[model samples]
Target: MSTPSHAAATAPRRRNETVIVFALSLAAMVVSMMQTLPVPILGLIRTDLGTSTAGVSWVTTATLLSAAVFTPLLGRFGDQHGKKPTLVAVLGVMVAGSVIAALATSLPLLILGRVLQGAATAIFPLALSVLREEVRPQKLPGAMALVSGTLAFGSGLALVATGLLTSGSDADYRDAFWMATGFAVLALLAVALLVPAPRHKTGGRTDFLGALTLGTALLLLLLPISQGHEWGWASPRTLGGFAGAAVMTAVWVLVERKVDEPLVDMRMFVHRPVLMANLAGILVGFGMFANFLGVSYLVQMPEALTGYGFDASILRASVQFLLPGAIISLLASPLGGRLVSRRGPRAALGLAAVLGAVGFAWLALDHRHSASVIGAGLVVGAAVSFGYAAMPAVIMASVPHHQSGIANGINSISRSTGSAIGSAVVTTILASRTLDHLPPGVPPLPAESGFTLTFGIGAAAFALVAVISRFGLRGGHTTVAAAEPAAADHSGRPTDKAVRTDTADAAV
Candidate 1:
């Protein structure tokens, strides 16, 4: 009779938890949608802004760089000061960026807005950290998966939404930016009204020096990779940037080692599980972006001329090739959570790597037909959901609970770095390889072999992730021998009572 009473009492709490997760997930989706809102409309942007193709590419390049710079910085701040305020600040910035982009009449202004919008990258990791504080441990994995999967889902939806808004060839891309602004505004209100402020705070000093060094190093390293094709791979500018990156890396390591409370803990970061998780994040991210950019490009190639393409509009590419993948990603998210809760993150990652490996391998081998391309994309998108879901599990399991924000932030940066690399490589491959024969009046087209090579490389990266997860994920789910669960009121700082209660319930 008492047990029944306890269960009845807890029912409402569970219902509230469900509502909270739904709200947070919605906010996360809006942030992710903004990140990819401009992807399908770059050509239109080029024409609208009267910019050269090379110049307009900065819209994406600048966003990548800005995301890399801000995610870790703001994440660390959120961990020390507070997450809700930090998240609200980030959302506010995104809204401003979207508005700026919507009203921009010049290329530089649009790029500036994109740079600000890039801060939304921090939103995904922060949402996961908040889930840890708000949801019960038993429910945490599933809640985290929902949030993580939304990233892939929102990105795909963004493409589809952009296509709808700019359906006509002559439709201005600025409408897409306005749509982004609306989503951002909605997200801001949702966070402010629905989600309560953070009760957990791991008070610490902001590592300004460490952040500067890391940010500068990341910028130096990524600028060349993103723009190397235009500048010439062997040009002085690219080489100099790489050299500067190398020097900055050495300096950043020294600074981190000497600081009492470093921006990033050197010892924890290099722990086998944490190190491997970050590495796998890079490889998985590479495969994800490669699949996304490659599929969209392949379908849009004019079928009449290229023969291999579907002659699809941006709308068709998103609907026919991308939507199935997004749907599969949604289906895979909870499944991934179940796998993580049962066998562990290692198993989930292994599954992701296998799916990614097989997906890209099939794409490389049998891409002659348009249907094959769509099928491959569906598989790869599901793989991304698995990978994204598992990644936070690995990070959360390995790092101390208090460090979740900064730790996940670093992991997010790794993914962003991998995306830039994948984008650069795919661009280079397609640009370098060209069809051997073409009619006099026909414009140039990429050889089919370029796509084959890109998929093969993506397959190789995922295969490598499998090997890392298998060997390097030992003991990731277990606490360190000397450390017991810490006590605090906020969910981020779980008390002994809270831990035992969740563990007991899970055992039931």
Candidate 2:
């Protein structure tokens, strides 16, 4: 075994480092909560804004679009400079956005604020980067799991809070933004008070060209997909957006090949673990968000019209989902860390994928009953937390410490892209099936059917992911080899002699 180094011993001795980790982690959780705040109130916002259901869906689409665009860019900046300043900058922008959203009267302005909020969500990934840099290896697994799980837990909490606050007679949808503002303020203060300065300063040229190209490409791609139905999917504007996205992505590939300091390292795509992990991330994201979309509709369906007997108000419906998801998140986060330590990332990921598939399948069958719904939600949430935690661990293990930020940024982007696709797919199905005009007191069976089918589809997707993870993800323990040549054999043994001996015994 390799000896524990002096650097590892000395790193945690600094008082400010501890504070920084705690503070940044908490801030990241708060930022994560903002993403889910509007989810519980999506229906309310739709009614209040007097917008089409499809149009109201864009509130989520807008935030995801901005998040997908900015996550990699901000992460790259953090890697090139330092996480502290980047985090603070993101928090400040988010605060401004929250204030704007709180005061907004128009749907367009609300979307603009959401866009800014999404941009600021990059702080979660940046915090992970910081943790990787500052925390000791021994402590990393748990810390990383906590960071990953917080996204789910915090979002659940935010949704629950929104449900409770908005259920009151005095509160409106705008109160959610104000709540976000308060969270942002607390995050900002925490960052200011607790985060430590980086020990090593970053030395690299900024890849402005790459950033611009990628940004343009993502925007072009996301715009059409996000608004295609509203704009007439086959209309000239939608077609033009698709064409522009294709051209920009093609150019981006060429630009990345030539740049010394590429914003995203295209070569990471070739690494088996990184590539497979990202693919898994995408599928998992799709599966996870599809569940969210399906459950939202399922809970809102009137009891007299549906399989379940409980007729819950909007607030109660939100809680029914939030409580189970939060409990599962809390349970799965630490469990993921333990699993990673024992079985390696590939095994952990495979297990998570399998669990997700089972969860979704269970829901498809059991959604008729309220208890079953909660149980299925818990299972799905646990699977998601596990998968989420394992993904970052896989990426961090596969790349150099310096490139962790970019690798994670890419992972985040993959998840966001998957989420966007999930949203679009679910929305399209519901829209295509549901009639534009509903007669008074008449229910939307087509919409309800669409959601059921979507959940089934998500279950199938997760099943495929589980199979792929089992076979496709290799080099689990050996992931550290990709970054550090000396640490190639991560079997925890010291030398190649030990590796050969173990191989020989296994061959026998």
Candidate 3:
């Protein structure tokens, strides 16, 4: 239907959009890599730094808490100021963090670097916001799927790379951080050059008080979730952490309600579809970490000692057992996007839930063989890809253009919380009961039953996702034009005659 001139103009625009998607996807992948890079090398780090297990655990915990604090705040900042500038600043910080991590000799210094890198978690939501502005509605789902897939792929890539880099007898864990530094720098350059500047801005004063309360609440909640096993689940610190989180959450809600311009709008925050999307995020997040940790640990168990494992080295666990799933996740992205485009996000999410449950059930029932572990992991990887594609779509469909960054940011935090819980649950289950009748001087290994229990729990989480998709999602689609609210100025007054046409209002 387009004329020659229109077609010619469209070609370049399409190319530009493609480049933009690539840059953002790369940035997202880098952030994901940062999160998982320490997983394979934690033991090495402990030895090098002479830290106890509890001390090394903080390396990962610091990043999680930092992400919880920064993601929503930076997301909202982008909405108010400008997404591109905010993205640039965040990436710059990531580069600095990676450099410091690469050079660090002390655990505290390394943890500081990780905290800075964790702030880059904001990149994912900001990328989604940019896609909304620059890409046509028809193309958005596919682009989002591609970007979302990178999170899983990058995570696996980190494990593989870390294993490979630290495989030698004298290898240093710092090598992995150096690799991250290179990738972060590349991502920074790509985003700077390729991504277009923001086309929409919601100028407003940041609610610093709201950010503080919410950040504190999340910190209190996640601290115990990540460290509960070490702290003893029934310890005063753990119980107090939960109690404080509940109190802080109540105070945050009250603060939000009273503010003229709040950090989060209570109406939108409580919207059924958005709420359901967040719930799905948590479950999906939990399932994801469960698969990663449960499989990695199970496979790497010394077969001679355990009599049930593959005796995989860290490298083998990463390359043989995990890399295939990551590749499948990347391959599934386009398919997931197609599903979202044709059947709506609810349908895509339902597919994710089905595949995830099946995958975990497979792992639970038959995990002795490499074929079983790899096959089940592939299915779960695809499920993760689909779930990732659908989540941002639900958010974009539910909220106005201006609120996209923070809305997606909140969803991101939900997923992180889920991942923390998944990791904790898996750790606790595996450590709960060690194998009986082990040889003298043998380290205590988890019983085979522990892996089965962990996978069963993962299956339950995904099954819950299916329940949410069926009961909680209604009117969950929107055309590109309708996604935008009525055009408004910095003061939030209408600046154009366009009506708010998004159908997600009733459903969300």
Candidate 2's displacement at residue 104, Å, is 1.6
Segments of candidate 2 deviating more than 4 angstroms: 1-21, 43-56, 232-236, 306-309, 434-448, 475-508
TM-score for candidate 3, residues paired by index? 0.95
In candidate 2, what are the lDDT values of residues 1-508, reduced to their tens digit?
4357866766565565567666876786787777778987877788788888777877878888788778888988887788888889999989988888888877898889999999987887788777776666656666677778877777677878888889977658998889899989999989876776654445588788887888889889888877876787899988999999999999988898788777766656456667878888888878777877677667776655554435666677768865687768866888887776556566667778777888888877767777777888888888888888788877777665556777788888787777767777777787677644566788664455676678788888778777656666632342222223122233211233211111111110
Instruction: Evaluate model 3: give its lDDT.
Output: 0.90
Worst 10 residues of 2 by lDDT: 499-508
Q: What lDDT would each prediction earn against the true structure?
A: 0.82, 0.74, 0.90
lDDT of 1 by residue, 31-148 (tens): 7676678888898998878899889889988888898889988988888888989989999999999999999999999999999899888887787777778777777787888888
Stretches of candidate 1 off by over 4 Å are 1-5, 475-508
List of clashing residue pairs for candidate 2: none
- Backbone atom clashes (below 3 Å) for every candidate: 0, 0, 0
lDDT of 3 by residue, 1-508 (tens): 9999999999999999999999999999999998889999999999999999999999999999999999999999999999999999999999999999999999999999999999999999999999988887789889999999999999999999999999999989999999999999999999999999888887979989999999999999999999999999999999999999999999999998898888887767876667898999999999999999999999999888888999899999999999999999999998988887777788888999999999999999999999999999999999999999988877777676677788899999999999999999999999996898898888889999999999999999999999887778754443233345535455333232322233453331
Lowest summed lDDT across 10 adjacent residues in model 3 is found at 493-502
How high is each candidate's TM-score? 0.92, 0.87, 0.95
Give the backbone clash total of model 1: 0
- Provide C-alpha RMSD values for all models, in order: 4.2, 4.9, 3.0
Q: Which stretches of candidate 3 lie over 4 Å from their true place?
A: 475-508
